[model samples]
Target: MRVLSRVGCHLCEEALPVVDRVCAERGESYDVADIDADPVLVARYSDLVPVVFVDGVEFATWRVDPAALDAALRRPR
Candidate 1:
């Protein structure tokens, strides 16, 4: 999983712990990317800073549901 985020974004900061806790419980790993650090990301995710992706596919945005995230992690890839 990965989180597309930017500095000083409160929503992004809020989403991090949710993602981290869920991934940690599932023994999965995730990374965070600063959208403003890359031009393409900045353009694509300019208004969507707290985006979450699982297996390279978008999973959630703005807010993350821990139950739903756990369900996704339980699925067979």
Candidate 2:
């Protein structure tokens, strides 16, 4: 999984820990990228910081629900 986020974004701040805790609990690895680091990413996700992707597919945005994330992680992929 990956989190697309930006500095100074509270929603991004809020979402990261939830991702971290849930992923950690499940032993699932995840990464975070700043949208502004790449122009295309910035263009594509400027308004969608804190976006979460599971297997390169969008899983959630803005807020991450722990139960939902856990359930998704548990699914066979």
Candidate 3:
């Protein structure tokens, strides 16, 4: 999974704990890359931090509800 987040973004902060818990509980591996780290990503996701990509595909963005995230994760990868 790819999580596009900023260093101090509130949305990203909110999503982190949830994602961390899910990953730990499900034994899933995920990568959290900062949106501002890559120039291309900084441009693409400047206004949309906290974007989520699952299995190399975008699964969710902006607002991520835990329940929805859980459901998305539960689906066969």
**For this target, which candidate reaches the highest TM-score against the unseen true structure?**
2
RMSD of each candidate relative to the true structure: 0.6, 0.6, 1.2
For all predicted structures, in order, the TM-scores are: 0.96, 0.97, 0.88
Between prediction 1 and prediction 2, which has the larger TM-score?
Answer: 2
> Could you give the candidate ranking by TM-score, starting with the highest?
2, 1, 3
lDDT of model 2, residue 2: 92
Q: Least lDDT summed over 10 consecutive residues: which range in candidate 3?
A: 59-68
lDDT of 1: 0.93
lDDT, candidate 3, residue 77? 67
Better by lDDT, candidate 3 or 2 = 2
Q: In model 2, how large is the Cα lDDT of residue 26?
A: 99
Encode model 1's per-residue lDDT on 43-66: one tens digit a residue.
Answer: 898898799998889999899999
The lowest-lDDT stretch of 10 consecutive residues in candidate 2 is 41-50
lDDT of each structure? 0.93, 0.94, 0.84
State the lDDT of candidate 3 residue by residue for 1-77, as single tens digits: 77989998998988888888887877887899987879999988899879988888787777777777778888996
lDDT for each residue of candidate 2 in 1-77, tens digit (9 for 90 to 100) = 99999999999999999999999999999999999999999989899888999988999989999999999999999
- Clashing residue pairs in candidate 2 (N, C-alpha, C atoms within 3 angstroms): none
lDDT of 2 at 65: 97
